[model samples]
Target: MERKQIRALGRRVKKIFIEHDEVKRIWSRFDGMRTYIKLDQFEDEDEEENDDDDKRNLFLTGLSGVGKSQIGKRYAKSVPRYTEIIDDEEIDIIPVIYVELPYPFTQAEFYKEILKALGTENFKKEPTVNELRNRVFHLLTKQRVEMIIFDEMNFIMRTKNFDNQSAMEMLKKLSNQLQLCIVCMGTPQIEKLHTMEDEYVRRFGRDRIERFEKCDEKFCELLERIEKAIESPNPIGLHDQSTGLPQLLHYYCQGRIGYLHLILKESFRLLNVYEENVQVEYSEIRLTVDIIKQAKFNLFRKNDHLITPDNVDKKEYMV
Candidate 1:
């Protein structure tokens, strides 16, 4: 071939090689296993014929990174599509609104945060907490919100004794008065919502929402899918059996969905930046590992006081 022709052929081959490699890597990252779709269930907006004005609630409990938010997003997507058809108008759809609970030092602060979220800036000027709450409720009700996703109920769980009780009461009241489906997405601590006082537990019905548990098969399937999504040749290693991808991921992220996404995105970006022969070499994996190790070390080192027996309590392993 001529010089120009040879260069063109080489460029085409490189593109093909990169595409093939990227495909495998992406597949490993987002296979169906970890994505949390019920194979038998189809996505539909009108899955539940909930009153448009009334809020429909569902709680998604899981470890920090086991895919609850992804499921929440999927459900959020379906709501707008279904509502659009039902309303038969070009209705504005926010689709989903995610709000992490503000860290509340005082019971009063909890109410203040809720007021701020609902745009009631001068809430303290209001006559009563109930009045301020009512005003906020009316505002949200006017927005035609389909659902309110509380992304970090764990924050409330971690509150001090007095603040914890008040926060829980406010949460329960918010769900009841708004009649919105309040999906509490949080870590394992959220289970306290179930085992707590009867008054709080009564509203969140036992059958309404369940906690997420990782089965061995499902976990392995998720790992396989993540590997396929990331196009990793050996997505998992034999060492994974004793401290496999799932365990490592759980340890690194506390199985939190948001953390997992963040880590995976960073890992993928690193892979893209350091490609060799159209593949992310083992060195890239080592780099990611080192990064995680350092992070774990820093967290344990800095937050030693928080690492009580009730908490991570693995300071010795941090090294």
Candidate 2:
């Protein structure tokens, strides 16, 4: 394989998205919330979707690498913005907006994130919190944004100086004023965010994506799905119990999808090296346990625990 082929394969592998059961379910939940803000459901696009409970806002929490941010991003991309003419003014109808909060996520920063997602100014120079908040509302309304996905919402709790109470108020206002179904996605610490305010607790319908406790049947199924999704001339057989690849992967990734993805991507790239070094056809090459082991070593050499010899599981543990 030449250098060009190797780089192409790298880019191709990164774009592959496997919509496993959990991911599909998350999309369904988000689509349902979207209906509440659609013109078909409400008399007007900005009409109130939240009743007394305000549970229409969705809160997605999960372990790191369970793909919470990916889910939000992919779902947002599924809906494309278009042009709408109102009173002879052409407004960009961005149906969904995905915003990732900056580290030390604060109230002013939160407001600016929305503007950034809308593709206007990514930052406002020293605008007051109230000023930024109002700008967010005005732009969201003008653009007719039906949904806002706030990724890394958990950072609110980790930062000491951030006024979460004020941020909560901003979220509440964003939901009610714009009739947007606000989706907050982050790690488990974000669960504490709802607990801080009783009203917020009632206002949010929460869902947690429980990661694999350990390598089990569910993890095996995930491997099978990933195998089918990979753009290879032949199957990688990641889930084949006889090959012992699945358990070995479990040992390294600990059931985290993000880590699993990284490992597989690196392993695929290794195929290029093996072919070039051996002066063999790419079609004759395969993803062997040794190849994956080397990829893991190259990837996690600094991390240490992920790249040892004794951890290799060349046998099945299915009970």
Residue 162 of model 2: what lDDT? 72
Best-performing candidate as measured by TM-score:
2
lDDT per prediction? 0.46, 0.76
Model 2 residue runs over 4 Å out of place are: 1-5, 39-52, 122-126, 213-218, 233-235, 271-281, 301-319
167 Cα displacement, candidate 1 (Å): 2.6
lDDT of 1 at 145: 49
Candidate 1 wrong stretches, greater than 4 Å: 1-59, 81-96, 105-132, 206-217, 231-263, 266-319
> What digit string (tens of lDDT, one per residue) describes model 1 on residues 1-319?
2333333433332222111222233223223212222231354746763333222344456544445555554444444432333355543334244455666444455555644544456733645756666665765665554345666777776666554666666666766565454556776677777567765454443222221133245444544455444443333441243544455554455433345445554544444433333543333333245554444554444443222223343432232
Candidate 1 achieves a global lDDT of 0.46
Tell me each candidate's TM-score: 0.49, 0.83
Model 1: lowest-lDDT 10 consecutive positions: 206-215
Clashes of each: 29, 0
RMSD, candidate 1, Å: 11.4
What would the per-residue lDDT of candidate 2 be over residues 1-319, giving only the tens digit for each residue? Answer: 4555544555667766778778888889888888756644536658654466454597789877778878889999999889989999888889898999878877777777788899877453688988888888888889988889999887877788878787778788888767789998988787778788778888888998755555667888888877666656566788876788887888777666787888888887677632445553545557888888888888887464433224434343322
